[model samples]
Target: MTKTLTIRRPDDWHLHLRDGDMLRAVLPHTSRDFARAIIMPNLVPPVVTGDDARAYRDRIMAALPADHDFTPLMTLYLTENTDPDDVAAAHADGLIAAVKLYPAGATTNSASGVTDFTRVAPVLERMAQIGLPLCTHGEVTDPEIDIFDREAVFIDRVLDPMRRNHPGLRVVMEHITTSNAVDYVKAHDTGLAATITTHHLVINRNHILAGGIRPHYYCLPVAKRETHRLALRAAATSGDPRFFLGTDSAPHTDANKLLPCGCAGCFTAPNTLPILAEVFEQENALDRLEGFTSLNGPAFYGLPANDATLTLVRETPEIPAQIDTPEGPVTVFDPGMPLNWTV
Candidate 1:
């Protein structure tokens, strides 16, 4: 077996580095491995304008360790009030990489997200003209729709029609979690792609509900059945350029996560590469790991792959159960098996 592997330093196409203390605590884990990350804009008060994005980028730079070479690719949270002119200017200045679409109440800190897609049509049109991709949460917030079915339903109701209306617009169905989503991406084949999360690839609904309720294993667009997890593995490891790594490594403190109505997210940044290496190795697709982790994300976002490389040694280092931050302790995702790779 191949014991050690080296590949171009990876980029996380989707990441949530919450500002202030949480940002300081978690940024190092991502920066240590990733060269760049598409920073999520769903802050407590979302990053909605060019000014907000620039300010957030500055804060990220300041927070980054002096020795690390990492870039924060900022994004704007699309809302009914989003300004097309500002988005264009940000992209033109290379301050932002994409616009994120979160259907109102869709996920964490998404109360300010878009409710009426039609209201944002002009903004989408402007993005299409300038070639800015729309990264979407890909789930509906309808109380009636079962949580497990939201992603598949969003494809039929919201995403498909939007693509049809603006054929030139590029869309990334972020952290998709179903076979239905996989089929949609394969069928579209152009100007559209999907990001598979590291946690989703490792866990399914069973991991969340089986034996007992595991809060650390829960995440939005919550993990589906075993069959869906298999599909995600196939898409991610298949060497298909449309699918790539986006470790939606959202972090919530243990206090919040253990509450009656806990937050949804898996804090996977600390152990993402090791877990991915184990998964790809198990699937006998180690050769394609670099493409999914390093190449595909940049290809979709129109950026160059990192010139630097990361080497993963075949050694099982003990992963900490949780990481400490000023806010509180945040639990690391338990992959439920021994990981034999470490970066």
Candidate 2:
């Protein structure tokens, strides 16, 4: 059996580092492993303009530990009233990596998201003209649609139409959870890709509902059936450049997570690497781990692969039950099995 493996330091294609105290507590975990991360802009007010992205990037840099050498590749949260000029300038200045699209009410703090897709046509056109990528939350917020079916439905109802209209636009289907999403990406010849989260690769909907309501296991675009989990694992470990790692490691205090209507997210930043190593090892596809976690994302975003490397040793690493933050203790995601690799 292989004992030690080393790969280029990875980048997170999708990440949520909430502002203020939560940001201070959680930023270190990701910085320790990832060389750069596409920071999500769905804050309380949301980062909607070029100025907003720049200011948020400054806060991320201020919060990062002095010893950690990490870069925050920022993004602007797209809204109905968003200025296409601001987005274009941000990308032109290299101030932001992508523009995020969240359907209104789709997930946490998404009340400010786009309700009318057509209203954002000008922004999408400008993005296409400049080669900027649009990162989508990938779920429709229709109350009638079953949560489990939202992702697949979004492809048909929203995403396909948008792509068909703006053929030149590049899109990243963020934190995708189904085989339908996999097939969609495969069907597309170019200008389309998907990001698979570390948590989604391990847990299915049953993980959240089986014995009892496991709030820590619950997340937006909630984990799907076992077959879907298998498909995500296959795609992630397939060495396909179109699929890559995006640990949607969102943090919610234990207090809020256990509420009657708890928030949706899994705090997986700290242990993503070790768990990914175990999953790839089980599939006997360790050779492809580097591409999924490190290389593919940069290629899609037009950035260079990280020069430094991370080595994982074949030994179990202790995972804390929870991480204590000033606001409250945030539970870390448990893969529900022994992980034999540690970075």
Off by over 4 Å in 2: none
What would the per-residue lDDT of candidate 1 be over residues 1-343, giving only the tens digit for each residue? Answer: 7989999999999999999999999999899889999999999899999999999999999999999999999999999999999999999999999999999998889999989999999999999999999999999999999999999999999999999999999999999999999999999878999999999999999999999998888899899999999999999999999999999999999999999999999999999999999999999999999999999999999888899999999999668899999999999999888999999
Poorest 10 consecutive residues of model 1 by lDDT?
314-323
For each candidate in turn, the TM-score is 0.99, 0.99
Note the residue pairs that clash in candidate 2: none
Residue-level error in angstroms, candidate 2, position 209: 0.6
TM-score of 1: 0.99
Q: Which ten residues in a row have the lowest lDDT in candidate 2?
A: 312-321
- Per-model CA lDDT versus the true structure: 0.95, 0.95
